[model samples]
Structures are given as structure tokens and as C-alpha cells.
Target: MDTNIIIVFAIIIVAIFFFIWGKIRSDIVALSVVVMLITTGILTPAEGLSGFSNSVVIMMIALFIVGGGIFQTGLAKMISTRILKLAGNSELRLFILVMLVTGSIGGLISNTGTVAVMLPIVMSMASEAKTSARRYLMPMAFASSLGLLTLISTPPNLIINDALMSGGFESLSFFSFLPIGLITLSLGIMILWPLSKLLVSGKDREKASSSKGKSLNQLVSEYQLADNLYRVSIGENSPFIGKSLQELNITSKYNVSILEIRRVQSRKRFHKPVDMKLAGPASTFQENDLLYVFGNINDIMTFVEDNNLTLVDTQETEMGRNALSVSKAGGMEFSKIGIAEVVLMSSSKLINKRVKESNFRQLYNVNILGLRRKNDYIIQDVKDVKLHSGDLLLVQGKWKDIEKLTEETSDWVVAGQPMENAMKVPRNHKAPVAALIMVLMVVAMVLNIFPTVVCALMAAILMILLGCFRNVEAAYKSINWESTFLFAGMFSLGVAMEKTGASSYMADGIVSGLKEFGPTAVLAGIYIATSILTFFISNTATAVLFAPIAFQAAISIEANPYPFLFSVAIAASMCFASPFSTPPNALVMSSGRYRFIDYIKVGLPLQVIIGIVMIFILPVLFPF
Candidate 1:
């Protein structure tokens, strides 16, 4: 091997090791590979960075925004729920419906988005049926991959399509994956139906707890905050007028929680008369601003007296009126103000910082109303408590503001499904517009009216313009920057492999080794190889590494590369043996309370059988 080829293989080996080790993130590993290849001079700066500008990557970003709009407007849930109602309390029907519906939607948008929209609904249905979510969720996740009907449905599809076009092969049509999707879904339904029963079959030692975290009211009652809510006002000459909430140190000094600030905007000619603002560290106090505070009356009184603030009366809160209620002013509306929970991940930067030092209100525009350390609630000195991994904080903020916490996934995970509460998705009325836009986008792609990326980008822009999301900010937040950057960065590694003859070298090794066994055997080797590789690494990465080699192998054999490329796409996608291999699989692990053994018994069998079937199926569908 040439020096460059050896260098490329070394980078690939280390990158794959990191990807499988799970110590570092796959995206970080991919970007590191790109850096090494560029720094080694194996690739030009333009070649190393070209993947960021790939059309496939752009399409992925647009599709994420479009998927976000669909979920934000509750459009996916609305359609799925009504269709699911037809199942009507039958577990078998629910299982079949979930597979078909999630797959169909997964074909149009993203598998992750499709699973997210359906997760709550599935859990709800399973609850009503008096069962664990174990049986439903894993299969539903598998079905999401099985539903890859469009070019943009999954990254592997998009990667394979890009490979074909770059290799001078005719591009696949929008619906090229339709029959493949149907076959896979149908096969999945048959195999998974019996295998998935094992998820719920035995006397499960694990309880039915989804471990999704506590509900809003549960947090209130557990912390004994039902009667602790108080609404107070900023009186004239209030010393707090000019200072931001961060400067006050009220939570630490007074031990009182200011949940939100309700402002009465003086009558304006065109704008709404009443406005509400969620209190954050940076939120400045204004004259006559009402503070929704949560604490004992004595502590509240001391703060009120010290700041020259007056206690306003409460109407009715979710906690209900109690002795602490002042009974003078209209209460803050829960429509805008809401409660959610966040648990710190092991790697959170705020782990060792005191609550005051962390500045929850200033940094995240939310207050840490309560913290759960193991089974105890830290109430008295919340501000002084140093944080730890797995510290569950009950956060209060405007629903829009709380949504921002989700963007920091590595630091903390939003506990439970608080955003799924009907009251939070205020844009539900825009479901029709969202649905129409999705329909038109799919139709345009099928008709070949524009390039696939153009059609997706147009839908994304329309979803934002027509009020399908909370705002442009929400639309932008919907895109997963990690996945986008990972794909973009890793594509350059593939380029380096091809440019350095490493891909052709591997292609020749496989071809010469197996060519005597004929194309069918070589195709089987390729499919089996891709499937095994995807078991430990991401399917997209597996597809990226193998696509070029598959294309080269077929060409060296004087055969069309379409079948070989299709095998790479299908094998890369359909891996189900391990949760770490795909996003959708890992998504259901906690929700289903599944052990690794459960995956082996359930997912591994399906994975092996699927590979076997596709080996024969791919050549028949797209002849070499």
C-alpha cells in the first residue's frame, strides 16, 4: 500500500474504534478524521471541506426544519392519532397500525421525527391497553427505518444517491425506495410481530416505569409547593427597578422563587394590551411588574417588605387557591408560563457549580424551583446546593423559553414529555397549513418539478412563513447540528479514501477474493459486510465507507453498480441488533426498559434474516 493509503486506513481504524467505544461522540470522531486527512495533505482544503456544501447535506437540514414544523403544529400526531383510533383498543391492531403509519411518515420526513411524534401517542395507547411500551416502541422504531420510501428519508439513502450521481450513474427518482420500503416493512411486520412479543412476554424483573421522569403536578406535590405559590407586585419606588434578576440574588438571599413576570402593557393602538414575560436572570424589573413567586409567606413577606413590592392576589392556579393566596390580582396564565424538568447528564458543565453560580435564570431564562437529589427534594437552601450529575431540577419558564433547554442535549435531557401537553403546542391550529405544505412538497418531488433539495427547502421556508412553528427561532432550533456536521465532516474522509486509491484497493481485494464465486456471491459478501460494519458504527458512516468500494467492485467486474449500491443502502439502514447502531433504536431503550440481552433476542435475529433476504432481493430489484 502507498503511504497515503496506509495513512487513510490508520485514520479510518482509529475513527471506527472511537465510534464503537462510545467514550467520544460519533460526530466528534468524524470531524477528527476530517482534520487528520486534511492536515496530512491527503486531501486539498477544498476537497476536505466540500462535503459541508453537498446538496445531500443541505437537503437534510431543510428536512429537519420541515419535520420540526410538522411536530410543532401537531400535524403528524393529529393524522396518526385519528388513523390509530381505527385500531380501537386492540393491541394487535395497534402494533400493525404503528408499524405501517410510522413507516409511511418516516418515508416522507425523518425517522427520528416520525418516532418522536408517535412516541407519546404510542405510550398513551399502551397505557389505555394496560401494557408496557416495550412491545410497541422497539418495533415502531424499526418500522421507521423500514419506511424509507423517499431519497431524503434517511442519510444512507441520500448518501447512496449522491454516490451514484458522483459516479456518473443516473440518479434515482424520488420514489425509488417505495417498493423497497414496502418489502422491508412487510417483512418487518411478519418477523417482529412474534419476536417483539418477547419484550413483554416473561415476568419482567424491571417494572413498567418508562423512567420518563415525573409530571408537573407530581413535582409540585412532592416538593410540597402546592400552597407555596404567591403573586407579588412591584410598587412605586421599588429598589429592584433598575437591576436584572441575576443581580438581585433573590433566590439565594430571600429563598423565594420568582417563577415569572407578568407585565400589564398600557393600552397601545395596535398591539395586545396585556403581555407576559418569563422571568430570567437577565430579565429587568419594571414599575408595576407582577412577580409570580413560589415560597413560604414569611419569606415572601420579608422580600416584599425589603424591596417595597406588594403581594398581589391569586385567582386560581394549578395548585388551587390556598392560605398563601393574596386574593387581589389576576394570576399569571399557565398558557405562556409552564413547568418542565431537566436531569443533568454525566458530562454537564454545571455539575460542580452552586445553583447561584450556575445562574439558571440568567443562562436559561428559567428558575430552578425545586431540585431532586436521589429521593430527597432540596428545598431550604436550593441556591447554595452544588449540582451533581443526575440532579433533577424542576424548571419554570415560558413554554417557548423552556423549549430552548432541549437544544443543550449533552448537558441535560428534558425529563418526560412535558412539551406534548396539549396546552404547550399553541400552534396546533396551524396543522392544516403544515399538512398541506408537506403534501405539496411530496407531490412536487414525485412530479420532478424541481431538484429534491429545492422541493425540501421550499417546504421548510413555507412552514416557517405560514406560522407552522412558534417562530423562526424554533424552526432553526429543530435542525440537529450534530448529525448535520457529522455527515458533512465524514464525507470528506470518503473523498480522501477515493482520491488516495484506498477505496479501489479495498474494492480489488474483495473482488479478486470473491469474483470466482460470481456476482451473486460477491453481492452477498458486500451486503453481509455492510450489515456487520453498521452493527457497531452508525449506518450513515457504514454507508459512506462502503458506497465507493461497492461501486468500484461492480465496475471492475463489468457489471452495473446499481444493485451493489442498493445493497449498501439497504444493509446500512436495516441493522437492528444493537441500540448504539441507530438513533431510533437507542431512542426506545430507556422508554422500553430493555436490556442488551433483549436486543440480542429481538433485534439480532431480525438483522441477520433481513440481510439474508436483501442479498437475494437487491439483485432482483436492480439488476447488475
Candidate 2:
């Protein structure tokens, strides 16, 4: 082996070690590899830095913004809600629907975002069906990976496509991989659906079977505040409309406490309501301000009647309460609201501070409706009580505000059932415009009206200009910079591998070992190798490193390179065997209470089956 090849091999091995060790961020490890390659003269500074300007990198960043717009505008949530409604009570039906919906949506949006959006819905379905969430969660996570069947489904798909294009192959059109993707997705659902029943523990099944499900109101009553918690709105003729909470002193005068205030501005008739702010001393009453108050029922009713405030009934009916509801001004209906249970982390900053002292409402924009410490539920006088680690808080606010709380994972973790109704808030009138932009971007790509990168850039810009995203900062924050840098750095490493002939050398070794076994065996070997690598590394990084080798291997055998390239793309996305393999997998790990062995037991067989199917299918599809 050449000295430069030896050095390149050493760098690659060290980089892989750091990636799996995970003591350092993957992007940082990749950048360090780039620095080493530059210093060793394996790559020029320009070559090392070329990845930053790669069109694929730019496209990935733009796609993140587009996906964020879909999320912020509640389009994804709407789809999830509709799909879940079709699930009914059958566990089998729910599993099939979840896989279909999640896979289809993930094919267009970010898989990570798809999983995040669908997670609460799936959990709620599991609860309604009286089964363990673990049974459905793993399937949902695996299904999300099916998005890779589309050209724009996941980053790895795009990386592989770019690699093929860079090697002078024709770029794949949108939906090119749909046939393979649908086949694998179908096979997965067929295999995993029955396996779930056998995998979930007996204790979980017994709990589901023995227990009669509880309603939202019944669950709230457990906190002992069913009678005290009332949703009342300030009427247009109310006397307290202009007064602040401190000035009105309703807590002392009426023996009722204002926990949260929900306000809707009438300035923009079609705009979604802003987050419900927690009622602090400085919060002033406004017309139609919905107040969640805790107090004596008689006192609250009397106070409402005395002030001409409208009482909004939130009783859980046979149809159950909608997670997101919009009430007009002057109507007795409640606005978009939600109640969530949050458990403070051991290192939470809110620990050791009274609710009032912590400015909990002002800081998090959520009201502390009740607190649970061990077996006791503190509903009355909770504001003065000091919070502690492991304390559970029942908070009430607009669904958007509660959603914001879920983002603060370092301070507290959301516990118990998710407030699904909260996710169904009114879409900004601009939601249609956002959806239209996304469609046009796809149409543009399919028609080749513009380069894929340009089309993505246009869609991202439209998301902001069309009001789907609130501002540029939101669009900016939506980009996962870590993944962006990681892609750029890995691209440089890929360049080094090609420039130093390392990829060709590896390709030769693979072709030599598998030549007697024929091209079918070669394709299977490459697929298996890439699949194993992705089990430990970022799928995008794995695709970047292996794509060139696959292309070179196809060339060595004097066969079409498309099958080899497709194998690389498909293999890189088959990361179901480890939770740490992908973000979607990790996101569901703790929620499902899944162990590493659970993934192996379920994912290993699926991976093997998919590999076997792909080896036979690839040559047929691409004619290698």
C-alpha cells in the first residue's frame, strides 16, 4: 500500500472510532479529520474546504427550513390527527395506519420531524387501545426510516444521489426509489405487526386488559382539583377588563386564583392565536381573556356572574375533548388550550423556588395549575409552595405554550399522557400557502425546472416570505447546524478518500474477493457492508464514505453502477438495529422504555430480510 493510502486509512479508522465512541460530537470528529488530511498534504486547503460549498449541503440546510415551516404552521400535526382518527380501536389497524402515515409524510419531510410530530399521537393511540406504547413505538420509528425511499425523504438519499451525479451518472428523478421503498415498507409492516404482540411483556398486556381506560376529566380528578378548576372568559362588559391581576386581587377578594390567561388578538383575522401567557401580578385582564382559575366552585361561579364573565365548559364528553379548539370572541367555547404534566429534572433551576418566586409563568409562559409531590396533590395554595426535584406539575396554557415547554428537556421532562388536542391548534391562514410552496418545489424537481438545490432554496425562502415561518430567526434556528457541519466535513473526507485512491483500492479488494460469487453476490456484500457501517455511524456519513467505493466496484465488474449506488443509499438508511443509529430511534427510546436488546431482537431480522430482498431487486430495477 502507498504511504498516503496508509495515512488515509489511519485517519479513517480514527474518525470511525471517535464517531462510535461518541465522547465528542460527530461533526467535530469529522472536522478534525479534515484538518489532519490538510496538514498531511493528502488534500489541499481548497479541497478540504470544498464541502462547505457543496450543493447537497446547501440543499439539506434549505430542506430543514421547509420542514420547520411545515411543523410551525401545524400542517404535519393536522395530517397526524387525521391519520390517527382512522385507527379506531384495533391495535392491528392502528399499527398499519401509523406506518403508512409516518412513512408517507417522512418521505417528504424530515424523518426526525415526522417521528417527533407523530410520537404523541402514537402514544395516545396505544393508551386508548390499552396497550404498551413500546409495542407501537418501535414500528413507528422503523417506518419513519422508509422515507429514504424518496429522493427528498432523508439526507442520506440526497447524499447518495449527489455522489452518483458527481461520478458522471444521470441524476435520479423524484420517486425513482418509490417501488423499492413501498416493497420494503410493506414487508416491514407484514413482519413486525405480529412480532409486536409477542415482544411486549405480559405484564403490560395485563395492565391494558384489566384496567378500564380513564377520561381526561377522570385523570384530572386524580389531582383532586376537578371541582375547583374552571375555565372562565372575561366578557366585553366585564368590569375587570382593564385591571391587572395585582390590581384586581381576585385571589383575595373572590377566593379564586387566576392560573393562566389565554388571549387572541383580533388584528389579523386569520392568524393563529399567540401562546397563552401565565397570569402574573402584572398581567392585565383583556376582553375575551380565558382564565383558568382554581378556587371554591361557588366562589368562582359567583365571581364569574358578578363580573359578567362567561363560563366555558370543558367537560370530557363521550366523544372526548378536542386537543385543539378555537372559540370566537363572545362565544362560550374555550380557545385553543392544553394541560400538561411536567416533571422537574434533578438539576432543574426551578428547584428550591416557590412558584411565585420562580416567576414560572413569566419565564416559561405556562401556569402552574397544580403540583404533585409523591402521593399528595397540592391544588390549593400551590403558588407559595417550593418546588423540588422529581416534583410533578400540572400546567395549563395555550397548546403552543405547552409545546414550547416540551422543547426545554434540560429543565424538565413531559410526563404521563401527551395533550393531543393541544397539537391541533388553528393553522396560520398561511398554512395553505406553505403547503402549496412545498408542492411546487416537488413538482419543480420532478419536472427538472430547476436544480434540486435551487428548488429547495426557493421553497425555504417562500416559507418565510409567505408567513409559514414567523421570521428569519425562526427559519435560521430551524436549521440543524450540527448536521450541516457534519455533512460538510464528511464531504471533505470523501474527497480525500477519492483523491488518495483509497476508495478505488477498497473497491478492487471487494471485487477481487467476490468475483467468483458473481455480481449478485458482490451487490449483496456491498449492501451488507454499508448496512453494518450505518449501524454505528451517521447514515449520511456512511453513505458519503461508501458511495464512491460502490461506484468504483461496479466499474471494475464492467456493469451498470446504478445498482451499486442504490444499494449504498438503501444500506445507509437500514440503521434500525441500534437506537443510537438515528435521531428518530433515540427520540423514541426513553418514551418506549426500550432496551438495546429490543432493537436487536426486532431490527436484526428486518435488516436481514430487507438485505436479502434488495440484492435480488436492485439488479432487476437498475440492470447491473
Candidate 3:
């Protein structure tokens, strides 16, 4: 073997060791490989940095933002919420719906994002159904990968597509992986049903309560404010139409707190989600506006009569009055509004001030909605009550503003991380726009109107430009920098392996060993090898290393290259055996309270079966 090939191999070994060691982050390990490659003269600096500029890397970053847009706009929540309703409280129905819905969404966006947005919803369902979440979390992680239907679904898919185009082979179409995705999902749902039973030990018979932070609904229920909420609408001829909250002075005059307002935009699209705004001084009341108010029944009734408002007898209103109606997530997933508990300190300057006298709306940009003193709640005249030491005041505001309250913890302390922010979905009024952009991107890719990378970039930019995300900072934050660095850095290692002819060396060894059995056997060998490597290496890194080798193996055997490339993509992504192999797996470990043995018992079997099935199915899907 050449000395340079040996060095390249050495770096890969060290990188893999560090990846499995888990003491350092995988991205840092991959980056160390890049530095070694450049310093050893195996690759030039420009070549090492080339990975950062790769179209594959760029597309992955943009896809993160696009996925964020879908999630932040509650588009993902809407889909999961609607589909999951069919399941109700049936465990079997929940299992099927989780697999199908998560897989479907995961195919378009990254599985990590899909799992994140869906995790709370599934947990809430399990809690509501009076079952354990363990039975569902592991399978949900696997389904996220099984939904690799589109070219952008997983990083491995894009890696294979790029490898094929560079090798002078025809690139895959948008729907090329559709059949594979269907087969994977169908098998996953059926197989995981029985396997997940093992997850429900006696300890797991009941869903574990979240130790993180208080959900909005839980806060509402804790303060006994759910019973105080009322939903009323402005009648068409009401004098309140076209009037601002400041003009109405409802808070002072009526002693009723307008917590939230839901408005239907002008000429609403048939299925478009309604618009919501946190009640504020400048908020204008328009015709047919639904108001969510918190106050005494007499006060709310008098205010409604004075304003000529009609009570909206909705399930939503009954839901709040009944139990602070939770969404599929079992939390109040409000977009424009959120709540937090603020405890006043003994030494605080505002200790003796009345609620309204604190000027919280003007000073802190939050409203004092509920006050808890000792065991009793001051509901009738909240703003009139004088603040005392140890008073727990439940404040409501926009999520971002609520989060800011946590930073200044001097005179008062914000309880449990303001916003439980992850559970709050905001700006869903733009879900229609995000949904349209997603459809447009798919159509553009299918029609070949733009290059695949261009299509992805256009969609990401449009998501930011069209108000799909909260702002540009959010779009940028959506891109997981660690993964981006890891992805871009690993490309350099792939390039080094290819440049040093190390990939050919590896490919030749595989083909030479299996030549007598023909290309079919060689294809199976490559898939198994990639799967094993992915156990200790990230799927993306493994795909980067094996993709070029797969192409070389097929070319040497004079066999069709598509099957070989597709095998690499599937094997790299269908890694279920190791919790550390993928982001979704790691994400659920602590939340699901899964042990390593749990993954080994459930995921290992699924992993082996999937690989065997795909090995046979791929050759038939794409002629070998």
C-alpha cells in the first residue's frame, strides 16, 4: 500500500475511534481529520476546504432552515395533529399513525427535525391514552429514517445523488426513492409493533412525567385559571369593531383580561389557519374576532353585554373551561401567546406594589394575568392585590419577550425557563405559505426547472423571505452548526480517500473477494460493510466514505451503478441498531428513558431485517 493511502486510512481509524468514544463531539473529530489530511500533504488546504463549499453541504444547511420554517409555522404540528386524531386513545392506532405521519414528514424534512417537533405530541398522546411513551419513541426514531422517499430526505440520499452525478451517471429523480420509502415504512410499522412491546417493562407501564419545564396548559391549570377563561366574539354590528384594546380599556373598566385574540384574515383561504395575536395595548378589535378572556364570570358577562359581543359556543371554549384544552402535544401550543410564573423576592423593590401599579405591561412587556398567594388565588381583583413576598404571579406575553424575563433574575425569579419554549409553535398563520413553498420546490425538482441544489436554496430563501420563520436569526439558528461542520469536514476525508486511491483500494478488495459470486454478492457485501461502519461512524460520514467506493465497485464489475448507489444510501440511513448513530436516536434516549440494551434488543433486529430485505429489493427496484 502507498504511504499516503496508509496515512489516510490511519486518520479515518482515529476519527472513528473518537466518534465512538463520545468524549468529544463527532464534528470536532471530523474536523481533526481534515486538519491531519491537510498537514500530512495528503490534501491541500483548498481541497480540504472544498467540502464546506460542496453543493451537498450547502443543500443540507438550507434544508435545516426549511424544516425549521415548517416546524415554527406549526405546519408539521397541523399535519401530525390532524392525522393523529384518527388514532384517539387506541395504542394500536397511535402506533400506526405515528409511523405513517412521522415517516411522511421525515421524507421531506430531516428526520431530526421531524422527531423533535413530533416528540411532544406523541408523548402527550401516550400520557392521555394512559400508556407509556417507551413503546412509541424508539419506533418513531426508526420511522424518521424509513421515510427516505425524496432526494432531500436524508444526507445519505444527497450524498449518493452527488456521487452518481459526479461519476457521469444519470442522477436520481425526486420520486425515485418512493417505492423504497413505502416498503421501508410498511415493514417498519408492522415489525416494530411487536418489538416495541419489549419496551414496556413494569417500570414503563405508565408514562413518565416531564422534569424539564411546565407546559402552558399545566401552568394555566395550576393557577386555577382554566375555569376563569371565556371565549366571545364581536358581533357584526358591535361598536367594538375597528377599535383598539387601548380604546376599550377593558382591563381597567371591565376587570376582564383579554389573554388572546383569534382573527380570520380577510378573504380567508378555504383551509388556511387562523391568525392570532397576544392581547396588547395597540391590538385592534375587528369584526368576528374571537376573544379568549380571563376574569370573573359576572365581569366577563357584563363586558360582553356592554360590547354587544356574542358568546362563541365552541368545543375550544369548552375545552379551556373543561381543562385548558391541550393540542396533540398535550400542551398549549400557542403561536402568539405564552405564560410563565414569576416569584417576587423578599428584597424586591416591587414587593408591596399592586399588580397594575407595577406597570408590567409597560416596563417588562408582559401582563400580570394570575396571582397565587399561599394556597389561595387572588382571582376577583388580581391587579388590585398588593404584591407580597413569595407571591407567584403568572405572567403572559409573546414567547420571546417571556424568555427575556428569565435573564434578569434579581428582584424576581422566572420559574422553570420561560416559555417551555420548545413546545410553543409561533407564526402558524404563514403555514399556508410554507406549505406552498414545499410543494413548489418538489414540483420544480421534478420538472428539472432548476438544479437540485438550486431548488433547495430557492425554497430555503423563500421560507425566510415569505415570513415562514420568525426572522432571519431564527433561520440561521435552525441550521445545526455542529452537523454542518461535521458534514462539510467529512467531505474532505472522502476526497482524501479518493485522491489517495484508498477508496479504490477498499473497493478492489471487496470486488476481488466477491468477484466469483458476481455483482449481486458484491452489492450485498458493500451494504453490510456500510451498515457496520455506521455503527461507529455517523451515517453521513460513512456515506461520504462508501459512496465513491460503491460507484467504483459497480464500475469494476461492469454492473448497473444505480443499484449500488441506492444500496449505499439505504444502508447508511437504515441504521437503527445504535442510539448514537443518528440524531433522532440520541434525541429520544433520555426522553424515552431508553437503555443501550433497549436499542440493541429492538433496533438490532430491525436493522438486520431491513438490510436483508433492502439487499434483495434494491436489485429488483433498479436493475443490477
RMSD of 2: 8.9
- State the lDDT at 396 in candidate 1: 76
Query: Could you arrange the candidates by TM-score from highest to lowest?
Result: 3, 2, 1
* Whole-model lDDT values for every prediction: 0.76, 0.72, 0.78
Each prediction's TM-score versus the true structure? 0.56, 0.60, 0.71
Can you tell me which runs of candidate 2 are displaced by over 4 Å? 18-28, 72-74, 89-95, 101-182, 190-226, 229-269, 273-294, 304-449, 455-486, 512-608, 614-624
Query: How many clashing residue pairs are found in candidate 2?
Result: 3
Sort by lDDT, top down from the best: 3, 1, 2
Give the per-residue lDDT digits (tens) of candidate 3, residues 1-108. Answer: 999989987887787666556677656776888899999999999998897897766776676677677766767666656655798767799899889888998887
| TM-score of model number 1 | 0.56
Q: Write the per-residue lDDT of candidate 2 for residues 502-578, one digit (tens) a residue.
A: 66576557656886787888888788777875654457767777787778878888888889888988888877876
The TM-score, computed over Cα atoms with residue i paired to residue i, of candidate 3 is 0.71
Clashes of 3: 0
Q: How far in Å is the alpha carbon of 256 misplaced in model 3?
A: 4.7
Model 1: residues >4 Å from true position, as ranges?
Answer: 87-93, 105-182, 192-333, 337-426, 529-607, 617-624
RMSD of each: 11.3, 8.9, 6.3
Tens digit of lDDT per residue, candidate 1, span 383-440? 8889999999888777767888889898899887766542334354476787788788
lDDT of 1 at 428: 48
